[model samples]
Target: MPGSLHNWYSLSWLDMLAERQSVLSGRIELKRLARLRDMLHAHDGSVTVNLRFGKRDGAWVIVNLECEATLALLCQRCLEPMLHTVAARVELGLVESASMASRLPEDYEPVVLEGDRLMPARLIEDELIVSLPLMPKHAHTSECGSLVRRRDESTGEAWTLDCAPPTSH
Candidate 1:
């Protein structure tokens, strides 16, 4: 059966870290991701997140998280709505102190464990936010609607402008 997460979810950080034997898999609605509102065209669809905890190197506990979703975002090239598919994988090391967090390996991102608790839903949301492209645009130049011939001031190179100039009253 498929598992789905609710709008709110909390878990014991210490226990999950110590036991290192839990797998959380669920889907969250786009509306729940308030931080992503500015970049999205509509709040309609669900994202799936799967997190598995495991012990790494006998000292630290790690979580492997996978997130998948299709977001309706305005294309930077077209200035119109387009579907952007996101599939990201992250490894997090649960750390108790800032010092320990700084010492984490390059492969893992440090997640501070505060008060022996954590909200898994919040972490998933954070991952999704970072996963988004800095400038979201369609792949093909032909698919873009707002692409127009323009000259670059810095390089003197010509390229298609992603959007048109705003009209002033």
Candidate 2:
């Protein structure tokens, strides 16, 4: 229901090409994709999608999708919040039937549509999550350099250096 566009394929052959080939762009609220929070940490901002769909190989469908989304992640060193952008480009095939899965090329990942409809939102979300960095670091590492305090092994007390003095004048 949330990620559905059932009527997109109902247009006449010529009209469908005219409308679907041009970029179909829209913003999907992040709240809708919150279900994947466990996989997509600190997610925020609207998920932007640009897509173009067309027929391929007579019956199969091809969808070229581009997506962008922002995520707030904790910096690994300082534990401060940092904004990270996720972008992904994917070309997917919608096979006519499940039986075609075996015949698909090694590089292609076929997505079977339930009922002649395609939901770009869900696909975009999946790609966004996959494209996210395994470890997000601060863009400005110098700002957080001072915050990297380490504890003395003996005393178990956190310590930070004020500054390293210049050796030569």
What is the total number of backbone clashes in candidate 1?
0
Give model 1 RMSD, 1 decimal: 7.7
Candidate whose TM-score is highest? 1
> What C-alpha lDDT do the candidate models reach, one value each?
0.73, 0.63
Which segments of model 2 are wrong by more than 4 Å? 1-23, 38-43, 96-99, 105-107, 114-117, 139-169
Q: Which TM-score value belongs to model 1? A: 0.73
What tens digits encode model 2's per-residue C-alpha lDDT throughout 135-157? 87777777564444333444466
- The deviation in Å at residue 163 for candidate 1 is 16
How close is every model to the real structure, measured as TM-score?
A: 0.73, 0.62
